[model samples]
Target: MTKKPRLAVLLGDPAGVGPEMGVKLLARAENRDAAELLLIAPPSVLAAGEKIAGTKLDVIALRPGDPLRFEAGRITHLVQPEPAGFAKLGECSVPAGQAVLQALTVATELAKHGAVQGILFAPLNKHSLRLAGMDEEDELRFMQQRFEVPGFTCEFNITDQLWTSRVTSHVPLREVADLITQESVGEAVHIIDKALRSAGIARPRIAVSGLNPHAGDGGSIGLEEIEVIAPAVERLKRDGLDASGPWSPDTVFIAARRGDFDAVVSMYHDQGQIAMKLMGFERGVTLHGGLPVPVATSASGSAFDIAGKGIARIDGLQHAFDLCVQIAARA
Candidate 1:
């Protein structure tokens, strides 16, 4: 029998819908059957989530130095210590940030030591992360630093039908063009291709989006396509990757949605994000591509306004967990 992959799961933020979503996800029998989950969160936080989700999980509560076990029909929960001044249920606070950071830190360490094959975290708020002293631009970068990954890395957003990646993310729009180099574009293409394959796509057909209007219109509109993006595509093709384009950003997604490509590599952040969110805001999964250990989370942020409300959606979290399980099993 194939053993289920062990996953280190974290409840993203105490003040947001992350805990509720996590609770709801664990309540499903199929998810438990698919992976051995090591849930990391404070006992109080889990109780609150259960209250909001209206479901009680049969969990094996583990203490320090307990032997980890994978039991059928039960989750193994490692209770995280509550930090000082933890945030309230629906408000962002420094304590919330600190608590999330500590959870992530522990998960990363577990992955580093090969105790777990993957990490699945719920939605996290960047504002709260910033308050917790995350100096990097985003959580992906922070994970890169934590894992000591030296090569190129990017986030891949996935839906049931399509996937998208970006050459540059979390930077100002004005700075995007300057950052779009042939090397960076090639790296983005390669990483997405690799990630798709890791997710079980045999040979991913990657569509590379143009940085400028009309893909430079043959050098009339802009030279980025002619000079930078097109050459990068050619290089990727020559290297035996099934990559094509410098396609117009507007039309690239249309082609992808029409089943022309397996993934689209965009030039900047919003180029792919706006479309992905608009297409499936509730079911999008964000895979931290190129990480040694599979790490994924919901593409959506912590919906603080509806934190304690039982109406919080778990679709994204479900997709995230499923993808993590798939990749971790392959690994």
Candidate 2:
């Protein structure tokens, strides 16, 4: 008999679509059958989600240090002691951020200690985390530091089975040029290739994008493509990773979408993000690639405007959860 993987599911920011989506995700019987889930959140938050979703669920409550047993189609809750302070529906508050931080901390700890094989969390509002006093620029950095993982880590934007990884993420446009070195480009290619294979692809084909317009038009527009990007592609090819690039950014995505490539290695954040979101904003899933344990969430954020209205789509979260389960089972 095949063993079901145990996954940590965190309810992100009670004020947003995370809670409701979490409810919608678990409400489906097929999702429950895919893995053994541990939902980490406060009781009040779950109650609010149930109210919004108009669905009731039974959870086995447990305290810290309790022995966990995996049951297909069942969920166990590690209830937070304090239930107060999460922001009301559709509003951002410090308490909401704090709750998200705490829940993520607990979930990461479980992964670190081998209690869980993968993690699936709902959408989080960056503003809420900043309000909660998060010093890091984003959750990925925080997770990396907390886990003490000493390797390349990246956020891979995936849609329609096509993946994109960036050479530099969350940096200013002015600083992007200087940061696009051979090492950075090579690392992005490496991670994206490994990530695609982990998702069940064999011998992934990768396309690398140029930093300048029209691939620098043979070094007339910019030298970054000639001096940095092209060289990186050649080195990656020598390493036998099935990589090719220095393609013009304008046409690379089009080529990949037409089945020419498996993944695209972008130079910066928006370079690939804008296109992926346009391809299928609602269906995109962001995998926290290069982590020892799989971690993922929606490529989009908490849609506060439509939150708690019982209309927030569960497509993205469903994809995230499904991918997490797939990766965990393989791991």
TM-scores across all candidates?
A: 0.97, 0.96
The Cα local distance difference test for each model comes to 0.90, 0.88
Give the per-residue lDDT of model 2 (tens digit) for 1-331: 1677788998788889888989889888898889888999888888888888999877888887787765556688888755446487788888899888888889889999999999999999878888898887688877887898886789999897899999888878999999999998999999988888888999999999999889899989999988999899999999999998799999999999999999999999999999999999999999998777999998878889988898888888899999999999998
In model 2, state the lDDT of residue 161: 85
Q: Which predicted model would earn the best lDDT? A: 1
Please give the range of 10 consecutive residues that has the lowest summed lDDT in model 1: 62-71
Q: Candidate 1, clashing residue pairs?
A: none
Cα distance off (Å), candidate 1, residue 2 = 3.2
Tens digit per residue, CA lDDT, model 1, 1-331: 1688999989888899998999999999999999899999888888988999999999999875687877887999988887788588777788888888888888898899888999999888888889879999988898899999998899999988699999999989999999999999999999988888887889999999998887878889889998899999999999999999989998888888889999999999999999889889999999999889889999888898898989999899999998999889988
